[model samples]
Target chain A: MKKLINKPENFVDEMIEGIILAHPDMVRTPGEDKRIMVRADAPRKDRVGIVTGGGSGHLPLFKGYVGAGLCSAVAIGNVFSSPSSDQIFQATKAVDGGAGVLYLYGNYGGDVFNFDLAADLAELEDIETLTVLGRDDVASQPKERSADRRGVAGIIFAYKAAGAAAERGDSLKEVAAAAEDIIENTATMGIGLSPTILPTTGKASFDLPDGEMEIGIGIHGEPGIHRGALETADEVAERLMRPLVEDLGLSSGDRIAVLVNGMGATPLEELYVLYRKVHRIAEELGLTVEKRYVGEYATSLEMAGASLSLLKLDDERLALLNAPASSPFFREG
Target chain B: MKKLINKPENFVDEMIEGIILAHPDMVRTPGEDKRIMVRADAPRKDRVGIVTGGGSGHLPLFKGYVGAGLCSAVAIGNVFSSPSSDQIFQATKAVDGGAGVLYLYGNYGGDVFNFDLAADLAELEDIETLTVLGRDDVASQPKERSADRRGVAGIIFAYKAAGAAAERGDSLKEVAAAAEDIIENTATMGIGLSPTILPTTGKASFDLPDGEMEIGIGIHGEPGIHRGALETADEVAERLMRPLVEDLGLSSGDRIAVLVNGMGATPLEELYVLYRKVHRIAEELGLTVEKRYVGEYATSLEMAGASLSLLKLDDERLALLNAPASSPFFREG
Candidate 1:
């Protein structure tokens, strides 16, 4: 196991402790549970609250986005495991203002179960609540069952738009609608060059011989559509971007936001290389690249690969994306 | 050979192309050479200009730092190779305001030789220039020989302090002095869990048997002080942090800034894990960690490891650290 962790079980907690210590000015624990990270000035008098949570090991995914104009709180779980319903409830409670709360996170079985229970618990507290699942991983399901697809890095788009809606005092229904709108237009697909080694087990998530790549791989090593010898970055970019463009029914004159996110172990230089090709592909398709983000916005633990996400943008979505937002890992103006 | 790149020879240029395309608002090529990235608003009338450059592959180190309140320009080179004097001179000519320019970069032989030559060329053009070399990797040399040490991630401190000085309209001499002051008080140490694979050769920089690590390794895979079985995160942190604390002669009342930077392949989670222990160590030693930055501020092309940098801080240094800055890969306030 080539990891810089003290103990397998202590990994998630220790990582959280470090984040709290390093960014106390921006994030904090709402109460005794160290797993719940809330914005330092959370529970604003009347602003809508945004809560996101899922497994750990994906830095800047759930925990790293807690701040002004972003998530109000987050519930963290162990690596690749969902946060418990109780933990999720604690996060919802901590960030709940009188205006109501929104549960925004990726679409996964365990996460859906826990977050739903948390919503029920919130209702018992007389606090209004709404839920929006991010389901942008087109590789996980066909368009006929898009709601069943897994959510991946494209959820960052939903986060920005929904957070901005809430920041502007949008009602819970409107904020949830904003999230749903972005998630509907977003699409993401990834290619994995190597398997993630789970820290607890000290084992690879899956087995693949060297020099092979898995196309449309999920963050947790779920089966993908294809596995073959690795191709060049340009080929990989085309394969990933083509599906996203088609899935969104994008055409000439379409405006979109592009994100080339590095899986944990890929270098930033390689990511930019991929982005270069993706940009060229966009230009050839007569698409207008309104905004771009090329870095490790989301990741699997030490997995060597990258994911491409596209959000077909409209004026409202673009405006919200441009609105002022700040987090420990993300920022915009 | 599992890198996501196109042609090996085009790696650096392609990456530069992607950066310019993705962040056109913040950075641009000063001229026809894609290798020379400069702040979009360079040649700030009477303000001092700062130019930094080194080999490629270290994102956010050279190219990524070119922006407002950081570096005005950068001369890029291929991976692990110094840029040419001609490129450095181009950067100097592009950013030279009437107030003069400061050459702030790492203390590598090839880099120093080229930058010095560039300084000579700048003088011929009537552009006054001063130079400041970052030498903060304590493991590269003993305290008495610190002047000859290799500059590592600690140089980010110099970039911040010196960039802020230049932005505030200081002369080139004052900006160089500010950088020198910060570099003088800074110390850095790193450990490598794996070797970097050069894109061109598809060869590992060095070979280490599985489960062993190189302590105090340089970013480009230079020999370190120790090689042994990988230790737990805390032990490794103590090993790296102790030397920096001692090198800086930090006392109980001393205030300092901490940066736990990831060498490309290391996960952000692991960096935070390392930072947790470093923070604990600083507290135990009675040092006040007034500021903290934990991320991939410097990298070695997917090498799996991390480095810890410390800057002994005073009011002026802390103020500069807190000053507003922005780049494609870095941002501060």
Candidate 2:
């Protein structure tokens, strides 16, 4: 439970200040509302401005993704908490160009509600906007209702595709469409090895037996669909990927892009072991893994387990994925 | 001491398999060695061939830096153990183009030994070769002996600079020079809040009290220069950055790139708090932070705490850093 901080309440503010300090190249202009952060080089005119925002713990996710070829500005909230509506609106207004802006991010209750409200506020500002919510975690919901699945690391995939399209001068509608395409084809499921400590509580968000894992858990320590004894890497991969493959209706001859992502605590060595089995299974199932990524693209503090994400790829998806992209979380050719 | 591993001996192998499976776009030839990995799209003859390797566990460090605009190949060894000379030789040979190949990585004892051996072997094959080692951790040694500090996240900066230089058709010598320049100018020092769990032992790598931290540790759970009760983010920033700033010989009005890197386990919010204090202190000293990054760049499993890296930027370093680069560990325009 050891942490470096003066007080829990001051954690976010202090962290933002530190970020501004460390990279004077990047700006953290605290808006009238403190939740919004506008990059100093933002307000790129005539480009489809990209904006992403979410809770604070997932660094580089909502914030690190801000820069050229990715998000232009990001609105941040407290750890695991959603940004306020005004904060989202301020971010939107700060980055909006006459070309309009795309509101892209994970699909969460707070984010949905607040982003919707921000879109309305932007309308008042005469800034046209389109929202693309990422709900790619198939394990969060049954196949019949993947729309309800929580968003997770799979959002990094969306960011790459959407960032490339927007950077290429795609219209906001086109950018939103590209993101939705990525979301529709992607499915993710995660297990937790250790819980993240909330800054305020200084205790892990949840608890599990030392030898157990909770399958299909949310990034914020939400109760997973099932809890089971720790399993082998092969078993772990199967448990996480079975539903994804079936839910996506991936069959023989399908091409997929796989991501064996760490929840933060898991080592890359462990992720690679899982990747070994995942690749074998996919190949056996006749799926072609055209593009692959392994590492901690998205993290959940020091959670120990890993998640498996499969994106069924078409020619266009492959092209977009292979396209050059630059961001803190991911990069491409 | 909870870990998701089934067998200790199988940890590294399984992890490697998982990474290839996860990224079908990358390949590890079978029955060869655990350390060798290459882009699935091999024989990329037209482009410069980039290669790097080192011990395992420093995720996104050696392996994650493989992609367009970055290293084309990576060889991995056991956790914190350097890959064998044979393995390095194979990697150099696999990535060698008629134009030549560049060997870029950290300056760990094992890495230097093995890479030197590989260079000899590659020369026998008549393939041109150049080597660049990133030795930027400032606290590992004194200012007069800064070359002794272990390379840490600052290597990522090297990858960015060298990768961009190579991508831009720089000769192998130029790319090597760029990486070396980054290493020479970079200074880093780290603190650990906890220890990583080695899969084999199923135990923490090091020990620290619940409210204490170890400053100036290596990424492999090595002991730091001092151990003390954890302090506020502001104090933590000063503790980590003071040595790095002074080591770089930076004065007021100097522009530097700052990285508030998590060792693992440390939350982004806390990193940002560290960032705030770092910025304040740097500004007060009349230093300008031209660039900033905060996250788990080079992690030590799930150990907590963070490190600060300061690279005094001149036009040459800034231009190289600002160049477009793509790698799993870093991407920038």
Candidate 3:
């Protein structure tokens, strides 16, 4: 593998160390283990705590969101692997204020299992905790089976909405309700042009032949709906958006926030190209785009792909999404 | 090459269209030609307009920086190619805010030549213009002849400092001096682990065998000083930093702003690993890091490598660096 790493086994530890060092004022580890990253000024008195966790490769997701007005703490695992329950419990304990703590993360099986165990552990400590799973990938399942779909870039929107609500002194139940609303309204799908290399094995996690594309692949190389010859940017955008728009039941005069997210290796220029097509489609469908973000929000490890996420917005969600946020990887002005 | 693009020839134009569409509130095109992108609030009365431009492919560089307290306008070019004099002239005319305009860009030959021609064109139109070239790549030249070095990631520092100065209502000469000071004090170098594929040609810009690396590679696949077997992140960091520290004459009590920038395909997880080593090295050298940015600030198209930039800071420069700035791709809180 031609990666700039010292040793594959130490990648997670070293990366966490680097993150803490780079953003000393933004993030910190609760214990010496360095697996549980908490906001530098976390545990705000009398406020609902927002905690999230998952694998490591998808940056600016679990860890990057741990900051003021966003996630209060994050449990980081190995690349494409779930964090242990102990780590999640530690993160929950570190960020719990008197109100309670909310656990927000994707719908991966390992992550779901671990986070549930952590919630149980938190209860033993007399801390009330709630769990909200994000499963917005339209291609992963049919509309009737939306709960079976995987979470992709749409989780960022959930984080933004829920974090904002929590920052406004919402109760743990209120924050969980807000997060569930975002998860229900948001939809995302992506096309993978290349596979990401596994750092430990120095090999591709999955195989994608040159000149072909995989539509709706999961963040960790999960099977998508189909594999076909590469298509034009307009065609790719249409294919990715058709399912999402239909899944969300978007209609004329619908207000929404759009995210054109890059999956690691895709360039921002290309992401913009995809965004141009997405915006045009939204306009044609008479959807009012209230806010737009086009860049790498969540990613695989150098995987060449792009995901389109649309959050059908209500007044409350829109206001929360626009709230101020700052982190090492994400900042809003 | 597996990229999410429609047609190779349409890559630059499509990307520009996407940028304008995604950031309608932040940027716009001046005329029918989409090569010149100006801030939506351009031509502010009595403010010295700051303009920068370069080839495409490096997203968030010339185009992404055009916003409040950053750049006033940007002239874009084809991938890895400098903009023509006519395009630069048009941008210069569009952003001249009655005081004057400052042309800031890297020291590449084609850019220097075209920008000089644009300045001449602006002179005929009675728009006073000043030029400040950024040459901060320590690996590209010897310290005795630093002016001959190529511009790289350090150019972003020059933009941040000078843009803040211009936004603060500094005179044209004052902005030029501030930009020149940043260029003189900053130093950068990069290491490439893999080659970038050009969209138009659909081929790798250069070649590298598996398990090998190149130190001090240029953004456009230019040759570096050394090529050998791949090294660990610590070793790579040391090699990349040795020349920059020596060239800058950094000593025990210097305060600097550090940027650990990814060259497209490198993961943020790996960037933090590199940053961990870089922070340790800076501490060992007794340099105080006043500000740190770790992300893909400047990039080649999906090139798997990274660069380190250090800008020696004083009270004046430090204030400018910390000043509030907002753009599509960059935001400071």
Candidate 4:
């Protein structure tokens, strides 16, 4: 594929430079080796700072959420790769603000290890820190071990709850707990119809048959649990939602918020068809859909497929869901 | 330009069906004359109902914004064609819950005419209505007549502000006023690196040499104001932003929100490159970016280009921007 880029090796550096240039309203503090992205209007001291880090490729995922009422800073790594401990530490210190900082990220092995090391480094600088990992992909595990599932689009919901908590002066620990609560309540499962083309490779990370799809796929081009011929829109929605509903054990009279998110390449029309089926199924199950979203919330480059996420809502989760947030990807009061 | 669609005529209907099937949490009234998308839990009488309508191919433009705290109904027409007046009228009546309804859409001749006609039809049924048209594409018209410019990605910001206003229980007139204010304050310009494939023609809507771009193109394959060899990201950003900055007549010390939106095919990396240049120039011009978004907010199929939008903001626009909105395409609260 033809792309407008210089050297693939310098892609990330150039990307970071461009981010800083375009958002001078945002601050890019170069640390020892890494950079931290922060809102230009850094608030006064005494407010807990929100920090998130992750691999690149998911634009507006880690960095897009940086601003008031959202993440205070973002530490970005290479595509599908975790940022280094030093990078995380630099971002933590840069946005600490003296109150504390909460490091929120997806539950991936590399991320956990690096974030733990970064926490140790931050503590040496007298900066307190807390961490919360999103583990919301129900399809990654059987129903008996759903908590061990990988994190995906459901992390956006966690970001909002955590950002709202941080914006309201919650301590780092409290904010971390709140984010974890949201993550635990949320569950996601994705299907990939087409593979994403890695920027460096310029080749698809993986491939499936032209008229087939892989269910329970990972964002980094990992194989899904099941591969089948292309199904009708209703069948696709059912296949993706079955695990979430079964895992969440959503029963009659339960209230939930549903997100039918396109992986990347699926059109909005197809998403709505999926939504129609999912809504009917939810009603048949006696659940009330308090809120709904259908579109590309989290994507894997130009991959085709969709993910279904459900957050079992209670008063607290609902309140946080209703809290205001502003990010490049998602904006609200 | 290969797409996975089965038949040309079934593309829109099939896609809409897929969305509803996947997002059972959302509602799409099937067998209707027009495709009407609505939140599943709609009919909330307390909040002012927000609605938008437009042509298809621009995924998430008219359809993706249907959800809580955003547009309650989005009437989608055929690819690059306006929804009929009756179709838009039915959507308005379906979502109207007595508080009132605000018809917000892009500034295109067909859309304006149809949506206005829909408003007239709705009023005859005792449903209060108001209209706000987005006219943000500064490059579509000469500086002397910038208000006549076509709308593009900037309409997303208008949807956001109007959604927030409705969510806050602003009366129909109040929401309409807020949306109009956003339209007046916003300016946008786009450059096309590649043309989108029109499903009917099964070919690119327009063509450019491998190393060229067309600036100031509309979402529906409209001819651009200027075309030239492809330039560096910096040059492209300047070309798109200079007109917007000049047309808006922004003075030093102005605060604005920025949107760096892709026309489908451009990668986030390039968008960031453009954003960097746009941000630097804006900073040099003494503008403060209160918010920034970088992604495919309003796309034209798989076109390769980007648009830069600046919404000059005061306290009111800023507050409305910060308000909670929950749409499929954009949501935080």
Candidate number of the best lDDT: 1
Residue lDDT tens for model 2, A120-234 = 9999989999988888877677777877878998887788788788888898889889989999989999888778877788888898878888999888887888897888878
Which regions of candidate 2 are displaced past 4 Å? Answer: A18-30, A38-52, A66-73, A95-107, A119-132, A145-147, A156-182, A316-328, B21-31, B37-52, B66-74, B92-135, B144-149, B155-184, B291-293, B320-325
Error of 1 at B169 (Å): 0.5
Question: What digit string (tens of lDDT, one per residue) describes model 4 on residues A1-333?
Answer: 434455566667767777776555545554544346776655438888877887887665677778767788888788778988988887887787888888888888898899999999999999998887788877677767765667888988888888888878888788889998988778888888777878788888897877677888987767678897876667777787777887777899999988887666565555666777788889899989877767667777667777889999888888887787765456654
DockQ (CA atoms), all models: 0.83, 0.50, 0.83, 0.25
Residue B160, candidate 4: Cα error in Å is 8.2
Q: Write the per-residue lDDT of candidate 2 for residues B11-102, one digit (tens) a residue.
A: 77776666655555445553367568875554466456778888777776777778776777888888778998888788777766676888
Cα lDDT listed for each candidate: 0.92, 0.78, 0.90, 0.77
Tens-digit lDDT string for candidate 1 (B62-89): 8989888899999979998999999999
Best by TM-score: 1
After superposing candidate 1, which stretches have Cα over 4 Å from the reference? Answer: none
Please state the error at residue A289 of candidate 4 in Å: 2.4
Model 1 Cα lDDT, one tens digit per residue, A1-333: 678999989999999999999998999898899999899998887888999999998887878888878889999899989999999999888888899999999999999999999999999999898899989998999988998999999999988998899899998899999999999999999999998999999999998778899999999988888899989999999999999999999999999999999989999999999999999999999999999999998899899999999999999999999999898899897
- Give all candidate RMSDs, comma-separated: 0.8, 4.0, 1.0, 5.7
* DockQ-based class of model 3: high
Is 1 or 2 the stronger prediction by DockQ? 1
TM-score of each: 0.99, 0.85, 0.99, 0.75
Q: Candidate 3 A-chain TM?
A: 0.99
